[model samples]
Target: MRITRRKRLLIGLVAGFFLVFVTGLRAFDPGFVTSIRLLGFDGYQRLWPRTEADYPVRIVDIDEKSLAKFGQWPWRRDRLGELTTALAGMGAASIAYDVIFAEPDRLSPHRYLPELTREGATGTELPDALAKSLPDTDEVFARAIAGAPVVLGYAVLSGDGGSTPALKAGTAFAGSDPTDALPAFASTLTSLPVLEAAAAGNGAVSLSARDTEGIVRRVPMLFTDGTRVYPSLAMEALRVAQGASGFIVRTSDASGEIGVGPPKVTDIKVGDFPFPTTERGEFWVYFNADRADRYVSAADVLDPQKRAAIAPLIEGRIILVGTSSVGLYDIRATPLGELVPGVSIHAQALEQILSGDFLSRPDWADGAEIIATFLLGLAVIGLVLAFGAIWAAAIGGILAAILYGGAIHFFRNQGLLLDPIYPTAVNLFVVYAAATALLYFLTEREKRFVRAAFGQYLAPEMVKRLEASPDGLKLGGEMRDMTILFMDVRGFTPISEQLTPTDLVAFLNALLSPLSEEIQQREGTIDKYIGDSIMAFWNAPMDVADHARLACRTALDMVRTVDRLNEADAFRFRARGLATQTVRIGVGLNTGEACVGNMGSDRRFNYSVIGDAVNVAARIESSCKAVGADCVVSEDTARAAADFAFLEAGAIPLKGKTTPIKLFALVGDADHAATEAFKTLADAHARLVDAIDANDVARALAGLASCRALAPAALHDFYDRFAERIDAMAVAAPA
Candidate 1:
């Protein structure tokens, strides 16, 4: 199907927003960010359970308890010899120490490198005098080391030049090229300098994640030799644990990329665009720390007695020994926290890569980000321009915040880092700023429209809504239950005719200002105005529940307002000059269905009320002046206005009607008690209807007089009008 202009605009806006959101992903690192937070301190503990394995490579930790029982760190080498011998005796597969032995023990004959041929040693000098004078501890330690699978610790560093030790034939990593089929980029990998001689291959633990500002965010996976990549600490641990010969690296020919892969699914989440990755495989982390099966600390197994504690914990485990103590200063800052262990961070990355649960940002992510920003900008501008500045601002802020938070969550939880920061921030700034500028122009234009449409007649608020939802400005009507009010300033035409044009305009401005403010304040919509009159209604545009009460209350408030105006000292109008003399206003209220909204020709449209309810309200207002009552309301309005006290005026013939309409006067605040008393008396008068029906006119007439006495002056004045009409009707009745 063909799409409309608005629909096409929506589609384009959405497409643009997605593009912007995805492009933002390139600004962040996935594995580095996710690994740190996911494997927090608590997560780190899971990799290291405090228990021994029965069969396999295991880690034994030198806990604080073991340290207290044994000697301090760097114990006599003979003790280490004994521990190694015991592990060899237990048939351990292999023993790897995370500790470094860069320096010789002081107890050795040379105090650094003792000669193997030395037969015996007592103090610093091994006896050259005797053939087998009992070798020093160094010889004993060397003997133990030769008897077991002892893998020593070594670290790699980057430098301009370094001496290359002769390669041990069996010690190098044996593997296929892991990156053979990968796409190439600028060399971001750093080199490692390796020189060591122990039992097995060495590995690196270098984390290289960056922060929001693109600083290093996490540990690197593997240390390189400025040419080739080597296994990391965690990878080495996995190798030791699995007893694997080496990592398997598979490669396929470029044109020989024969197999069709599964279709990829992209998640365009709610927030900012994510960091782009080359493919699905780049984001992940390995988990390793504190596992009884994986790590061993040197401080534990040195003591022969404490060695039992470790053997039970590390006999068949793959243990990683990294710093948890704050003072070790091995912690690195991450999005997760500043105290995350540098070593464990690498472990998490390894785990993710191995599990193949990487956060994928396709090369298309950049386009996604650009699109997301554009779309969000359009939405923000549209809302702001279509509504007002306040609503537009609210929507823009909410959308921006949601998108930003969503991108971060997707990264951390799903291994997908959609970079939302830049796009969301840019969207908010650009959209709001642009929308504000546009709105300012629209507002200025609207003022002109207001002047053209209603400056000659209608209220300012009406003009604002007309511009706000211009669709509602059509000449149509909706039937709505509304409270209609009619207000007239008594005898204003003669006064206006006598005054100059300037004085008339000034007077009208002054009088209408407070009166219009009063109506609007009560949420009453002004329908229209006759000469010196205000016709308004409630429950339109937005419906109010107690609109009838609101209408009546506004009428009462207007009555009080006139008195205050008459008392004011700023007397300029003809009526304002009169001393303490109140100007009279007649108000009528009715509640019923009326056609409301713009109700006129296209050239001269107006938001107004039409139909019988409006006519009755006007009739009631006119009846107020004719019957000498300040305010009159239909019984329907009176019933709905529970807040105001109402007193009944007997039914009277209204002009252009044979049916006598039931009416009530609106009593002001002081008359509440009197009005309530009148209700009671009126109830009694109604009961007298039964008396009159029984031909007991005496009691009926008596109750009527009682009702008159109890009512307030306004109600009584209405009752006197009723009495004159009743008397005339009775006299006019034929015998």
Candidate 2:
């Protein structure tokens, strides 16, 4: 139970070794752990989502309403041209189409009306201007696009591409080339040549994230096909709207404080606005809930009446034109748990760019979390070894709450992503493992202590008891009748702290010398000494006359011996300039059948007794501190030693037990048993227990008061604590 400095350090090192192993496993970053970290980030968004603001950004949704009014998929380029013109007329800063125009419009007059002209004899000849205008619909669309700051979107195929996207903006790197950081795509499906040439800029609409579930959490700000790097749809929109010529991509520095990392993109700037990004050149999106105010139907932009009414939402806003129709299958999931149009992702990204309020994880984030996990693990292990499992767990729970809550707060207030789940999880596992390891170590040390204490055969019977069984060298032992006694000094910690090592050793020897003499005289064998406590058993090696009675006599004598030392000032504490203090102890005795002989690890063995009865003795001794008694014995021991002066304590529940055990305090020898005062006090104690069993709080309290008055001064604290327990029960009971 007590470890020296060297042993404690060894324990810490063992736990630290375990910590390093677990941290290595985490460094592997398995999929499940990644999912857990992502899930945690998602929860933060759900709890404190971005607040909606009227930014200069909007999504021109080709929703079900628009589709119903405009017929079906792939409306003629003339209609798209008309929609483009309407947005431009409404003062849209930049209109980026999330749709594609890969082929020429089939409805152009030369392709269809030429047949009508040949077959329909009854139809009049087309007017010259109308015929010319019908054949040049693509030209009309191209002209509309050329008039506005329009950005054309293209599909980025994952496999080999037929053709790379035409670059619209020049890119310049600030440090070592970080081309690898930009997501690379195989090919692209660009707009029609004429439409693409007319647009102010062309960008890839494709978005990729850390998750495969298509949850748009982080979207790349830039992309590349082996030869050239291109801006994403959102970035292109910002550049075109701001009339910026080229972009600057900054990687980590090669000198000074920001140096020392592998070359990765640190920030990207478009015009005057710059923002941080993940090493992969991706921007983290802090999303708001689906807002009706953020979307304007394509039909509304086309409808003269609706367009007049909704012009405010379109004016001066960078609009992303994309289909929100479910049948189109362009819907994607968001961290806010909503199925949104693909264009909504771009819109939110653009919004954050404009507001300069981006969610970012620093390069040092991983290192910070690893250190945090290790430090917390160390603290938890120390607490478990020094205190106990319950106290450590309580403190761990509080620390974990603070960490998780702080993570949420930082995300909400500072747009910072800090993970708490992994560290807390690591700490939880560390605490459990440390406790189990320490328990095993304690058992092994006790075995070694037992071996050293009884290296020589103290008695011939002890040698016979240890060697008589064939399995003596083995740990499995034989059962025999025994009487177990456990004794502990109550205030040993504080008392030991006050004395020097030499003085403390001398004091302990002086205190234990007389107690050991009484036990030996009574034919009790001392099993071991754990710190200031003693464990001894009777009838283990050989049977003695009334072994239970002898054990009880030894316990009573030990109590009186401590009392004598305190009264005589035996240790001379006052001479050291310290206030006079009495040394207190608690003793427990139990008689039952227990396993006795050489038992422990096969490599090392010890002569000892272990069983439920032995465990009960230890529990009873511990409860003496709670019951305010010097010596307590179980019912079996009381029955074995019927002539001893014993007063009933109670049927109290011990740790890890289903039923309570009956216990009594051993007062004196047979002469004390014959006294009338002992009998009266015993009667009162019995009535108090009966009142308590009957659930009569008032009667129990009154009986307890009477018993306390009749009992000796030593039991007053027990009665006082007993009354408090009864009151607590009454308050907790139903009215």
Candidate 3:
């Protein structure tokens, strides 16, 4: 649970790498990430779409029905002339052709006249008058366009070098020339000179950009061929309809950031409508599904009877002329998930401009996304480290919801396209997954260490308790009131010397195995093994309410267990014709404040206890050997284990202590403590301890002798040791 600095740095580096990868993807505008971004954009449109299409823009669709009624496409320039005349008569604002007139009409009289002249000619001078009398179909269409409010469309090619459309709108650059920044075209295919010249304005119909998936999501409002910038069909239509003489292009200023230089066309002003566009002068079209309300069949417009019924629809609207006929191959994909006539894309852009509802992903939006990615990634990592995976996942989900919901809300309510998909996917899922996985591995390793270190020393339940809360096992010390136990086999060197190394190991395992179980069963953690000695403690790495009582009870149980082991060993040794040496252990229990936790250098550490209390416990165990008792505990521990019986051992100044402290010989559990004999012995032993602490050598001797007479076999050695101490004090006294 303790995240090292190195691990944190690694986590941060991984998160940073993701941010950089996404940012680089955005900078390069790679097709895959762009595809996902566009998909998200499409999702936003679908969830809460532009439900109203109220702009005065209509598409004169040359649909399947129209093709059926009016014959196939290239419906004769004269018929197109008639259609244009009809719309002009109906008071249409502007008529823009999404169809390009790149070449002279094939059905023109010029073509037939030349063919007929050749058919009838011998050399020259054949059907000259007949050729002169035939009216040219292109002239007819050109004349009609000249007479009507029409904007001619053209296609811009990448390198197919063709004629460029004339820039009808007077363009004035507000900042540096934006031709370099605008979408570039090597050449163009415009209407025939006669037709383009006669039309009120000319604009490019070719889309400057397409999504990676080949969906047309935006149309450039302007494009540049060399140094000349030209407007799109939709922009030109709106400009001529509004009677604007020119377009005012606002480019970025040179005074901005040093490396950025001047930006591309930022806004294209046409009369009173100031349209916001991408740096490339493109507009994100908030498309509506191909709507019946926005269409008027071209055939219907050409039909005299039907023309009257549809006149209102085309009247006073900017009519875009293009085909929706599938055979014509003019249909294009849109965010609305429908294929609409390409002309409808132009119509929708013009509609959005006129309505002043735009979808914009500004230059600053990229910066915002980068920042969000970094911050959200950090938050996720922090949450996972501090609170673990479950809480981190909950918080991550909430963050993702907020981002997605906010993006949708902005797109629907404010027409601001703020991308949430990249940040949510990268930060919430990708970064979260990386950080969580790293933490999981690190924490699991820590858990394994805890289990391996404590598994053999603690009970299964205790190991589970430590595993469940490994965070408490910080690699530093904290002072806590603890009960430390130190147990050692009494006089084990002689027993070890009598046996072979294999026998010694077997003997040690047999003696330490049950002792470890006794300590672990009483909720004690074994610190380590020093030859025959096993040091343990309670109330750390986790909490135990009656730690002192548990330590005392473990000591009593250990004594009883060793007694049984000694009996078993004695019988086994006799049967094998070996020297019979009993296995006896001395246990010391001390209750006081000590520092407990992982200790040692960074490379190697041990979860153990230190300070005076721990040292005194070891000294108490050593004292047990001199007293010939199995267990000795400090007065503090004796008081803590109120349910157990303790016979007071005369005070002795512990090693490194200035004052003598009282000690107790742990006798039995609560049941034994209630016996009349234990109560009587406890009273007599307490009196003897008081006499010794007062330095009343004569009185201490008398009290010790009386206790020796009344004591059980277990306390006889305890009494005899103190009597010898009193006699020594009496001998050393000044005369």
Most accurate candidate by lDDT: 3
What lDDT would each prediction earn against the true structure?
0.55, 0.81, 0.82
Poorest 10 consecutive residues of model 1 by lDDT?
264-273
Please write out the lDDT profile of model 3 over residues 430-549, one tens digit for every residue. Answer: 777877777777667767987887787678898887777675565578889999999988767777777889878877887788889999889899899998899999998788899999
lDDT of 2 by residue, 298-375 (tens): 988999988888888888889899988999999999988999988898999988889888889878777777777777
**What are the root-mean-square deviations of the candidates from the true structure over C-alphas?**
13.0, 21.6, 5.0
- Which structure is stronger by TM-score: 1 or 3? 3
- Best-to-worst order by lDDT is 3, 2, 1
Evaluated at residue 290, the lDDT of candidate 1 is 29
Name every residue pair that clashes in candidate 2: none
Question: For residue 672, what is the lDDT in candidate 3?
Answer: 91
**After TM-score superposition, what is the CA distance of residue 556 in candidate 2 from its true location, in Å?**
13
Query: Which clashing pairs does model 3 show?
Result: none
